[model samples]
Target chain A: MSTLAVAKKEFHDGIRSRVLAGLTVLFGAFMAGAAYYYTEITPPAGIQSSAEPQTIAVINSLIIPTYILLPIIGTILGYKSISGERESGSLKFLLGLPHTRRDVVCGKLLGRSGIITVSVLVGFAVGGLALYALTDAFQIVDFAVLTGVSILLGMVFVSIAIAFSSAVRSSTIATAGAISLVLVFLFFWNVVLTLVGYVAQELSLIETAQSQTPTWLQFFASLNPTGAYQTTSIYLLDNGTRSVPSNPPFYLEEWFGFVILAFWLVVPIGLAYLRFDRTDL
Target chain B: MPAIETIGLTKRYDGVTAVNELDLVVEEGEVFGFLGPNGAGKSTTIDVLLDFTRPTSGTVTVLGEDAQRESQSIRRRTGVLPEGCDLYDRLTGRQHLRFVNESKDADDDPDTMAERVGIPEAIDRKVGGYSKGMKQRLAFGAALVGEPELLILDEPSTGLDPSGAHEMREIVQEESARGATVFFSSHILGQVEAVCDRVGILHDGELVAEDTMEGLRNAMDREAVLTVEVNRVPEDAIAAVRALPGVSGLTTDGTTLSAHCRDGAKAAVINELEAAGASIEDFGLETASLEELFLAYTGDRPSRPIDKPTVAAGIDAAGERTEGHR
Candidate 1:
């Protein structure tokens, strides 16, 4: 109850100080403007269009924001959660209270996660409204699934940021680390995975390559929380249409991707809590 | 019962002992001052008491609860003003107080508490904009918000100006009057002497002396120095002054004679010197103060002497002293 009380106070302060509001505005404007631009060019309803306009539109408008903006928001929300407190000397003040270290970490995570979740929802809402206004009335289920995937993706990055903030002592270092981590997962891991997959293909050992390549790639890919969440999001929003193939033929399935995403959310947080519990701060 | 107790508490960092074999007791409703120079383990002792750092050995009890094993409960009943505390600079002073009060589950009116500590108007301003003294006052308010059973303050007045320091001293007194056991650490002997009912002088990770201000002065057997200006000084008069029951090492400079004597020996030494054919022009006696008492016990050294306690040798010496006392 005390932890939540502290978390609620943080949430109120974050909202009232216009931190959350500013983030919401920025994200909303970006999502809405992008969605509007795409819809204006495409002209989705009643017009003679290419095959699978819905799927292509959704992929182009929805996936870009979810993939790019959600992680950025997640990192921004949590990058300074612990290390900022340390830098300001408020960490010692909080630790001086009767709460356990776990309570402090969890409370901060909950507070920042609330902000991130709200910002993601609002951005998506504005974008969704823009899409619906340009076209006809959109189905609620499609938006719900998309938002759910975005929320999970946000959680994955939030957890990773919390872990980095707890491990590092300086706010600058923690912020840089959290942002770098997200960027690596979002962009670099895919390139590295592609290179590895190519090298395995060229070795002239198809069966051996098939066995070695996908398992290792999936393992490495899971290390990047954002990547894991993106993999899961793609699977959830797949709708039996365009989907990224599992690296290994054996590793295919939406459930396996969900498990990896869930692991990212839980394991990094668990490790952060463990490290925080024993830390002297 | 003691509100706080530590037995054989020790803390070591990288082969250097910060707090060594510390044994302390603080009674309920008593203001206990922990005195030490920098790096003499004052903060380390407070850290161990607050469970911020685990002791290398021994036990610590706060409000009848183990400080380490039941630290949460102990912390619940104790409020701490840690050294070099950095508050949330972005939050207003009122917000900081509200958060701490909420966490403590106390029905604290932040406005009133802030006013009592002389920061009423500034409570709305961002803490980053507060001066050092104002920040220290806010820290004091946070520590007292819950009316905790034990208040642990480490260098609470470090950055405070003279008036702010006076106000902080008053708050400590008020807290003690409210039946809270106040355990504070300070390097200023005058402040401790003014506020604390009992004081412990820690030297090199060990409590070298523990007593009331008067008791410590007495225990040190500090003598008063009497300077006597006379019409003519005699060698025999100086000898007679030194031979007095409580006087020793008398020195004379032509018409002025100076000698160190037990506190109550000044009258007797002067009477004897006067009777021995010296016309005293004027006389003054310097009574033992806390500063002198500290110097006498710590050997008048500007810095703490670095000496590790010998395990077996120290035990034997302590056993002998205990037996002698008994």
Candidate 2:
């Protein structure tokens, strides 16, 4: 009950702030623009729009931007969720109530997840309408799958950002740390893997001609939540337009992507909850 | 059982001690004032009591529950107005009260709380637009939700105008009349004196004095100082004033004479001087200010600016004096 109260207060605070409205308008615009680009602008041969339905083309174009924008928005929504309150001294009013520290962390997670969820849904609704009007090819199942995974992806980053927010005393440090994690997952994960492979080759840990991917490497690649989001979307869409190796291992399978996303959503928040419970605010 | 008790409670930040080994008790249904100057560990002790910060060592119990291990239960029955706390500025005053009411599982009407705090017209306004005093009042109202058994108010008078402070005291009195224990902290002596049944003075992380208002008043009354300007200083008059009862000390410098005396002894000192042919030009009497009262108890003034070599010895002697008095 106390956790829900805190969450209600948190969500109300989000509603009262201009950030939520701003994000909603920006997301609606972006979704509409993405649909408009595929249908009206019809960019060059690189998009392959002539070969596929307009809805599929719009979804394809959206994947990259969704991967990029959702994480940034999620980070922005959550980076200061705990540390900002702690620094500003409003946390006193919170802890002065009957709520436990666990209640606070869980409440923040639930509250921020609600904020990200609304923005994602609004974006998808606007995009779905645009796809209907512009192309007459709105695949409700496929669109819903992408929207669902996008929401999950947003929550994954919110959890990660809150982990940093709860671990540190300074909001600036939390912001820096959460954004650095997002950057790592968005860009550096594969580069770091390649570097590891090179160093392993130098150390004679593996042969140079090992072309087949190893099980351990497959598992490690699946650990990145953003990667998991894309794979999960592909699995759920089930359009059969993409190919996969026959009888691939479970770690390489798409179902494992949901598992990875769920892991990302829970583990960071769990660790942060433990740390925040012990901290002085 | 006592409403609040701390045994050997100590808190240290990095290497600096904020609250030293301290044992304190406030009985149920009493108005106990925790008095100290700023940065004197008053807030630190309150923090530990509420389990906002853990103690380095020792045990605390609030309302018969262990303060650290059973803090949720303790807090459920206690309403706290913490020091230096901020409200959610984007939230309206009504929203803040409703949140507290919901959190406490109470059905307090937000409008009633706002009216009680004297902010009825501003209940729907966001707290961001509130003046500091209004914010303080709103926070105080938030603490009143659920009709808590014990009220721990840390500097509740901060940011309040005089009338606001008086209203707060009346609320405290009303709460006390309803059988609630009220524990408040303040640096101002007169504010504490008005409502506190007893006050404990803290200095440098230790309690220097714990006495009822009557006891403190008696101590202050005994040491009232009188300074008189005279037309001439008579050598014979100084000896006569010194010999009078209730006058502890007499000193003369040129045509000025000062006497440290009981409240009743001022007139006798003047009579002695006038009879001895030293005409009095002017006379004034002074009771000790809170700073001087602190000096009387600690042998060191509460103000931080002046550093004296005697402070260390003063603390030791004051500790023994307090122990003997207890």
Candidate 3:
């Protein structure tokens, strides 16, 4: 009950803050505009229209918003949950309460998760409805799958944010570290893999060139939450969309990507909770 | 059972000891005052009691529970206003009160608490905009929100104006009257003297004196200064007065004679003066005050030693030895 009380208080304060509100409004506007443009402008032109069903266009529209918004919001929200409380001296007041340290950490995570979940659901609903009105087409199954993958991607980023927040003392530093980490996973990791692949090909390391790449690199690429989420999203929209594939075929094998994405979500958050539970603040 | 107890409790930072083997006990419902100068371990002792900081040695028990072992339980029943405490600036005064109330599972009626502390009108204002006195009052209100069984306040009167200080003192008294133990620390001797049932004076991390105000005064056997206007004051009469037990010093200003003697010696001195052919015009006994008593216990000179331990003796014999190299 006390945990719920804490969650409710945090949720109320979070929603009222100009930072969160601004982010929500900006993301809503951008996603709605993008959905409208994609449905109204691209399909009617038939300039390069593929034979894929319109459900594919709808999935692509939703995925575009998820890719652009989830990571930024996740990093911003979770990065300050603990470090900000400590910096503001509220940690002592919270510690003085009857709840255990574990309860505090879990309650904060739950509260932030609640906020992210609401924002994503609302954004997805509005964007999906706009796309449906503009294109006059929708696929419930693809939409559900896309929403699930987007939420999973958001959780992975949130977990990473929490992990870094617990390790840093200042809120600004924590937020920077979380953002840097997400950028590394999303952008830098792919660059490194591409370099490795080019170097391996030049050397002609083995007869089976595709198989010559290190298993660890493959594992890391698969563990990239953005890449995994993108792959899973594309597979779910296979019959409906003609959007560009976010990850190569080698990165999307079987259920490997989902298992790896789930690992990314659980492990970092679990470690973050452990670190938080033992910290003095 | 005692409401709070510490045995050999010590806290050390690096090589310096903040509180060294401190042993203290406050009886249940006692308004006990912990007195000390600026750096006398009073706040450290309170921190150990509240489990905000861990002690390096010994033990602390509050309300029959070991403070460190059962800190949560202790916290559940204890309300503390820590020294140099800071509150959430973004929260309104009422919000702060409600937060504390919800945390303690107590009733959340911020208006009543605010009214009691005389801040109801500004309850909706952010604490950041509050004056120092107002902040102190809000902190006090938070501590009293749950009405816990034991209230541990470290210099709770800091930043409070005279009226606010008086109101806080009254609240402390009220809390004690309702069967709650109130342990407060203060550098101001008069405030403690006004309400404390007993006080323990700490000088340089050690408990030098512990007794009620009257008990302490009596223990010191303080002297009363008596001024007498007399006719024909004789040298022999002055000598005779000095010769009496408890009479130590005498001075005469023309027809006026001032005599200093142990508290109960004024009457004997007067009787001796009258018999010695000195006609007395007026006489009065001045009782020792808390200030004088405090100085006597904390600021005595060791060169001229009395039979009992005076403040100077305590300072030199204990304070010096304990404070060496610290």
Candidate 4:
């Protein structure tokens, strides 16, 4: 009950501030623009109009934008949740009430997740309408799946940002942490995999030239949250969304991507709450 | 049980002891002024009582519940105006009050609370535009919801104007009269002198003195310098006062007699003056000011500027620094 109270305040605060409103506008614009790019603007360049909703033309474009947009939005939502309160000394005010530290942590997570969820909903509503207008063969189920998965993707990053916020006292460090998360998951995860793959192949851990990357290595790379979001979206969009064959190990299968995304959402906050609960505030 | 009690309470940050092993008690319905200079551990002690920071060793009980284990129950009945806090910038004062009321399951009217704290005019305005004093007032109003059993106000008058400060003191008195204990901290002596029923002066992480106003006045008597102006210096009165047990010293000038004594010696000296046939024209008595007594315990030499960095005492709550962990 107390958690809901804190979350409600956080929701009101987020909505009242210009940051969340700006997020909604920017996200909606991006999604609407993606709809045009996939249908009338680019059109996939071959089948005249493969602008079907469940096809690669629409869902792929929709999923690609979230890989980049959600991290930025999620980080913005969460980077200051706890650190900002600590800086302003308002955590003392909240804790001065009958709240435990656990209530605060849980409330922050729920509140921030709600903010991101709403932003995603607004963006998807615009994009969904555009897709319906643009494509003649739109599948409501696939579109609904896309919206649900995209929200989950954004929530994963919100948890990440909150973990950083709760674990560190300094906002500068938390901001840096959020930025580093984007860089590591969105950009550097591949570089790390390539370097490790090269080292492993050189050590003769696997066949050379036949495969520059091992099966285990490929499986591990695919679990990177950005990669997992893409894989999971493709999996949910099912039949003929893409031309790629789906014959891989069980660990490398698309359903594992959902598990990995869920892990991202739950694990970071769990670890962060442990550290936050122990530290003197 | 006392309203608040700490036995051998101490808090150390790394090697720096913020609060030494000190015992403190506040009875059920009195105003206690927790007085100290900056970094003297007054805030640290308050933090421990609220369980914001864990104590290094010892125990604390508030309203007969363990401070650490049962803090929620303790806090449910406690109202706090935290030191140096900023309100949510986008929240209106009414919103802030409602949040507090909702948290405590309280049904306070925000307008009535605002009126009490003198912020009714801007209660609808966002806190971002509020002056620091207005924010302080809003925080003060929030702490009053549910009519808490204990009110812990840390530097509650920091940004207030003179009238605002006086208003806060009156509220403290009102709360005390309603059977609530008000424990507040201040670096300023004047702010607490009028309303604090009992005061405990903290310096360098130690409780140097704790007493009522009268107790303080009697204990430190170098402050009681009495000067009597008569038509003639009364030799008999001077000798008789000199004979009193607490009369530390006495002197006679051309037409004035002065005595340096403790509490009870003054009345005897006055009686002797009337007996000696010396016509007393006028009289004046100067007791030690709170500032003088504060300085005496703080040991900050009056000749030196007060900005000197406090030397780390390197002592634990038990006194000397010991290596063994508890």
Candidate 5:
């Protein structure tokens, strides 16, 4: 009950923030624009003139926007979860009540996740409604799956940001951590993996084709949350229209992308809570 | 059971002791003032009581529950206004009060609490727009919500004007009158003197003095300044006054003689002067104030030559309740 009360307070407090309101507007605008481009722009430009391709095409087109927007939203929402409270000195005021440290961590996760979940749903609704009006054969199942998985993707990043917030003593360190995370997940992750792939090829350690990286390397690179979201969304919505091969080693199968995303959502925060619970606030 | 008890409680950050092997007990149904100068470890001791920080080695029991083990249970029954802390910026005063009430499973109307704290007008406003005093009043109201058995208010008068401080004291009196044990810490002497039944002085991470209103005065052994005005300056009368037990530093100007004597020794000095045949004209008696008593105990004296109570007088120290305590 105390945990829920805290969560409720956090949600109430965060929603009033101008930063969140601004992010919501920006996210909504991008979602609506991306939906127009998918429905009207691409069909006349000589791709998928049937008013719809396989469900994966529409889902894939929407992915890049969500992929970029959700991380920014999640990181912005959660980077200061614990450390900001500590800095403002409210953590003491909070702990003065009947809450244990576990209550605080759990409450922050639930409340921030609530914010992202609501924002994602609102954005998806705006985009999905436009796409429905524009296309005759739009698949609602694929849309729902994409919406649900997008929320999960946002939650994974939120969890990681909060984990960083809890472990660091100051918000500056947490901000530094959040930025580093964005760099690694959004840009640097694939570069590092491709570099590794090229070096392996040069050394004759593994046979690799220009069209596809080794299966193990592809699976390893997909462990990044954004990569995992893409892999999972594509494979789940795949209706066999693209020329890309689908077969791979068992562990490298597309379903494991969900496992990778779940791993990200659970592991970092689970580890962070151990330190947060033991250390003095 | 004691409202708060700490046995050999010690807390250290790095090598510097924040609270030394301190033993303290606050009984039920009394307003206890925790007094200290800055960096005196008063807040450190309070943090330990709330389990916000663990002690290096000791046992603390709040309402007879082990502080670390039963912290949530202890907090559920105790209301606290933490010092050097900030309120939520985006939350309105009403929302803050409601959060407290819901967290404690207590039903307290926000409007009534706002009225009680004298902040009814501002309760609906966000705390970001509140003055420090308004925030203090709201925090005070939040602490009152559950009618907690124990109220631990650290520096309750901080950021409050004199009128607000006075009103806060009245609320303390009302809480005490309703049978709640109120333990508050403050560096301001007069405010604590006004409401606390007993006061404990902490200095340099040590419990230097603990006693009731009268007991603290007596325990400090602060001198009473006795001024005797006489018709004529009698040489032997001055000598006789000097010889009185507990009297020291006798001085005179014209027909007036001033002497400093221990609390109860002022009368004896005057009697000795009269016995020596000096005609009484006019005189003045000024007993040590609570502020002076506070300074005497917490002030720097030469580190206790040999009678260091922690060693020689382990069982009998200044803060130990000798009389009118417990």
Candidate 6:
């Protein structure tokens, strides 16, 4: 009951914040605009020219932007969840009641997860309606799958952001940590991988340096939650239209994307909770 | 069982000890005032009692439960108005009350609480627009929910007007009468003097004095300041008055002389001054203010004319119950 009360308070606080409301509106508008452009302006060549075009074009249009925007929205919503309260001394007022430290941490996670979930749903609803109005082939099942994956992706980033929020005493540090995580995942992970690969080649750690990408490298690349989200969506939404490698290892299979995303969703918050529970506010 | 107990409680931040090795107890159903100036470890001790911070080396129990291990259980029976805490700015006062009610599993009406705290007109307004005193009143109201067995109020009168402070004291007295133990902390003695059953003075991370108000009053009653304005300067009168039995301090400026004396020596001091041939222009007696009593206990040396033989030793002698106090 205490946990629920905390979560309810947090959710209402978010709703009252003008910044969050502005972000949500921007997200919905962007989604609707993207859907309109994909179905009407410049559709994918084969799918658009086909006799019965599918919603595959709209689904494909969502993946790249969702990967970029969802993480940012989630980070903004969660980065100050705990540390800001601590700095402002409201945490004292909160802990003065019967609520425990565990209740606060878990309640913040649940509250922020609800916020990101609603954002994803609202954005999808706006974009889905636009796609339906403009295109003849809606493909409801595939579209639903894509929306579900986007929501999960959003929640994964929220969990990561909240982990940093709970672990640090300063909101500035939490922000820096969360933004650094986003930058590493979005832009620098592959660059760092290539640097490591070059060093490995010079040290004679691989047989061919310039040949096809190794299965191990592919698995390593999939570890980034943003990349894992895209792969997971494709895996779930594919209608026998995509190619697959023959007899890949179990860990390298398309189904493994779900496991990687789940890992990102759970591990950071669990580790942060252990630290938050023990630290003095 | 004691409402609150701490044994050898100490808390160090980095290298500076905020609270030294100390033992304190507040009995059930008593209004125990925790008195100290700023940075005297009063807030630090309260923080440990609520488990907001762990003690460096010691143990604390609140309402018969271990403060560290069973903090939730302690909080379940205790209401705290924590020092330096902020409320949710975007939430209305009524919403804030409802949230507290939900957290404590109580069903208190927001309007009634608003009326109780004297903020009825501001109940529906968001806390972001509240004045400092209004916010304080709301926070105090929050602490009164659930009819708690113990109320831990750290500097509860801060940000209040004189009348608001009086009302808060009245509420403290009411709560005490309702059989709830109130542990109140304040830097000002006036706020706690009327309502507290017993008061403890903390100085430099150590408790300097603890006694009932009646005992403290009796000690203070022993000392009085006698001021006399004479027609001319007389060196012999200064020496004569200083030789009086109960005169411990003497300071003179031009034609005016002030003596810190016990009640018994007031007349004797006047007689000695007249015998030395000084014609008194005017005279008055002044009892020590509560602030002075607080300072004398905390060792700040109350603001007064320069001391001849500082009255500290005399005041210390009067504070006879002070044990292990510097």
| Model 5 TM | 0.83
- For model 1, the interface Cα RMSD in angstroms equals 2.0
Q: Write the per-residue lDDT of candidate 3 for residues B272-300, one digit (tens) a residue.
A: 77788877654444544566555444543
Most accurate candidate by lDDT: 6
Q: Lowest-lDDT window of 10 residues in candidate 3 chain A?
A: A43-52
RMSD of each: 10.3, 8.7, 10.9, 11.2, 9.9, 7.2
Error of 4 at B7 (Å): 1.1
For candidate 6, the docking band is medium
Instruction: For candidate 2, give the docking quality class from DockQ.
Output: medium
Instruction: For all candidates, state DockQ relative to the true structure.
Output: 0.43, 0.71, 0.23, 0.66, 0.62, 0.73
| TM-score of B-chain for each predicted structure, in order | 0.74, 0.74, 0.73, 0.74, 0.74, 0.77
Better of 3 and 6 by DockQ: 6
TM-score of chain A of each: 0.82, 0.92, 0.82, 0.91, 0.89, 0.94
Fnat of each candidate: 0.66, 0.89, 0.27, 0.77, 0.87, 0.87
Give candidate 1 regions above 4 Å deviation.
A13-24, A42-56, A170-173, A194-223, A242-251, B217-221, B224-288, B295-326
Model 1 over residues B1-326: C-alpha lDDT tens digits? Answer: 89989999998988999889999999989999998778889998988887778889999999999888888788888888988788776688998888888888998999999999999999999887999888888988999888899999999888898888888899899999899999999877877778899999888899888898668667445665566666787658867777888764465556766665675666677677667777665555555456756654443343221122312221244334334533
Arrange candidates, best DockQ first: 6, 2, 4, 5, 1, 3
What TM-score, to 2 decimals, does candidate 4 have? 0.84
Candidate 3 lDDT over residue span A27-121, tens digit each: 77777887777776664343135534665755675676677678888888788877887776566566655565656666666677778877778
- Lowest summed lDDT window (length 10), candidate 5 chain A: A43-52
lDDT of 5 by residue, B270-299 (tens): 667767776666555555456655655665
Pairs in steric clash, model 3:
A56-A240, A56-A241, B296-B311, B297-B311, B300-B311, B300-B312
Best-first order by TM-score = 6, 2, 4, 5, 1, 3
For residues A48-111, what per-residue lDDT tens digits would candidate 1 score against the true structure? 3543446445534666766787788777777787888877766767778887777777887777
lDDT by candidate, in order shown: 0.75, 0.83, 0.73, 0.82, 0.83, 0.85
Residue A214 lDDT (model 1) = 52
Give lDDT tens digits, candidate 2, residues A1-281.
88899888888887566877787788788888888887689743434454344456567666776888899889988999989989888888899999999889888889888988988998889878987787655678778889989999999998899999999999999999999999989999998788877787898877888997666767886788989998887787656766888898877889899999998899988998888888777
